[model samples]
Target chain A: MKLVIAVVQDKDSNRLLNALVEKDFRATKLASTGGFLKAGNTTFLIGVEDAKIPHLLEIIKQNCESRDQLVAPVSPLGGSADSYVPYPVEVQVGGATVFVLPVEQFVQY
Target chain B: MKLVIAVVQDKDSNRLLNALVEKDFRATKLASTGGFLKAGNTTFLIGVEDAKIPHLLEIIKQNCESRDQLVAPVSPLGGSADSYVPYPVEVQVGGATVFVLPVEQFVQY
Candidate 1:
């Protein structure tokens, strides 16, 4: 068995969940924030047999799409606080960052 | 790379985070809940090199420990509501559920 950890934007979370549900795949949702963006996102913990991975990835791919977002850049370290002008830069925000991990054991009571 | 995913009780989260930071290991906190108990918990995503796995696990082991918790059991399915008597059952609540997953790729932008 493998555990698929998909970190997706919050806007795509609901849609992704619905898609997974329709395919009979169960998921555990975790509220997370991106390390770079510091924006809210959803991390899904999905356990599946080895064979179903491709199908699961397809579902995630179809649901989440990358989109441009404007974000203020962080001030440079050791730079004067008053002189720094934060500019809103456009960057891709929406899309799923996925990781597939091998599960040593899974137990439920 | 290995991503150490640890699901721990909310009570032990701060302590665990502090311990990881002291060791210079960065972690991302995710708000999660247990499947069976449906109680709030904290899931940490810690990305580390292959050699540091043992140390990370040790820190988690030392910080989180199992504890007895009294919880009301869920009513039986299809059972009549009027006849059911809710009883508080003692169950082990604390401790970390850890998963170590291999990362195919790691990126930061």
Candidate 2:
């Protein structure tokens, strides 16, 4: 078995979870945020058989498509506070950061 | 920086998160269920400096305490349907499974 760790935007989590449920793919959802954007995101931990990885990825891809988001710039630490006008920059969001790891042991109990 | 992934019981998550926040540690919370008990659990993804791993663990230990849970036994697939009556079994739950991984890239843009 493999553990699929998928990080997706909050907007996409509901759809993704629904899709996974429809296909009988069980996942654990976690609330997360992007380090850069500081926006809400969701992380899913899915335990699946090896052959189902591609299917799981396909489902995630369909639901978590990347999109442009406007975010205000955060001032750097120790930087001059004066003349710091925040600009809303468009950055790509909604794509997933996935990590697949091998499971040495999976005990239900 | 190291990414600390902690799987804990739902009952303990709020306190754990609060404790971490008090210490200026940022974490991402995920909703999960145990495979055996099918009870709600929470997974926390914390980004921390390596030196503070011990402290983080201590905080987790203080918040997420393991306890016994009563779960109904599930009958095996293809077993006799009429003869199977599930009896409640006491099992341990609520301890955290933590994974510490090295982060090659830590970007805040």
Candidate 3:
């Protein structure tokens, strides 16, 4: 079995969850913060058979849409204070960052 | 090398984190909910070398202690309503549920 770890924006979480549920997929939702943006996101732990991976990815892609977000970039460390600019920059966000891992075993009680 | 995904109770999270930090292990903390108990829990994503798996497990075991919890059992589904009785049951909870998965690649920006 493959364990699909999907990190998605909070705005698209509900819809993704609904779609997964509708497709008879069981997922564990985790609230996470992005490392770069430090913004709240939802991470889903989905265990599925290997053959169903494409289907799952399609579901995620259909649910999550990339969107533009304005965020102020963090200043570089050890940089001159006068060189720093704190202007909001438009960045593309809101698409799922997914990782597929091989599970050695799975047990439930 | 392995990615240890540990699902632990919230009560043990801080202590576990401290222990990991002291040991110089970097981990990602995620807020999660348990499937069976429907209770809030913490899921830690710890990336470590193969040789350190045992040590990491030791740290998790030391920090997370199993405890008895009073939980209301859900009534049987599709059964007679009169036959169902709800009672608070003493259940063992709070030990880490760990999943060791193989990582194909690791990337950071």
Candidate 4:
């Protein structure tokens, strides 16, 4: 079995969880936020047989979506601290950060 | 930096996140349920320096608690489906399932 960790935005978690459950794909959810945006997101810890990874990824890709978000640039005006106008730059968020790890052992009790 | 994944019980998640934030450690939370009991739990995706793993673990250990929960046994009776009488058994839950992974690359934007 492989341990699939998918980090998705909060807007997509519920729907993704529902889709996984519908397909008998059980997973655990954790509430998380983005490092750069500090926006709320969800991470799923899914345990699955190695053969089913492609299907799982398809499901995740369908549910977890990416969109643009407006935010102030961190380094406004070319690193000028003083006399700076913070423009709301558009940044893309909501994509999934996925990690697939080989499971040494899986126990259900 | 290392990616520390901690699967903790729902009851202890808030406290643990608070503790981590108090210490200036940032993490992402995922809402997840347990495998055996199908109970609600939280998974944390913490990004930390390699040198701070022990300290992160200490924080998780202190905040994520373990306790017994009553659940129905999967196989109520041995090789008998009709004459099965389900009995609730006490099982342990609410401990952290931690995985520390070596990060290949780290970026913030």
**Candidate of highest DockQ:** 3
Best by TM-score: 3
Ranking by lDDT: 3, 1, 2, 4
Clash pairs (backbone) in predicted model 3:
none
Task: Pick the winner on TM-score between candidates 3 and 4.
Answer: 3
Off by over 4 Å in 3: A21-24, A32-41, A65-94, A104-109, B18-28, B33-37, B54-68, B71-88, B95-97, B103-109
The TM-scores of all predictions, comma-separated, are 0.52, 0.48, 0.56, 0.48
Residue B66 of model 1, lDDT score: 78
Which 10 successive residues of model 2 chain B have the least lDDT summed?
B30-39
lDDT of 3 by residue, A34-105 (tens): 752335788888877899999999999988767788988688679988877788889787788898888875
Clashes of 3: 0
Runs off by more than 4 Å, candidate 2: A36-38, A68-93, B1-39, B44-109
Lowest summed-lDDT stretch of 10 residues in model 1 chain A?
A: A31-40
Better of 2 and 4 by lDDT: 2
Writing each residue's lDDT as its tens digit, candidate 2 over A1-108 gives: 777888888878899988998898867776566652346887788878899999999999999878888989888567787856588789887877888876543423
Error of 4 at A41 (Å): 1.2
Q: Estimate candidate 1's RMSD in Å.
A: 9.7
lDDT of 1 by residue, A7-54 (tens): 777888999999999899989998786431336788888988889988
> Per-residue error at A108 for model 2, in Å?
0.6
Docking quality tier of model 4: incorrect
| Reference-based lDDT, residue B29, model 3 | 93
Q: Cα deviation in Å at residue A83, candidate 2? A: 18
Estimate the TM-score for candidate 4: 0.48
Tell how far residue A69 is off in model 3, in angstroms. Answer: 15
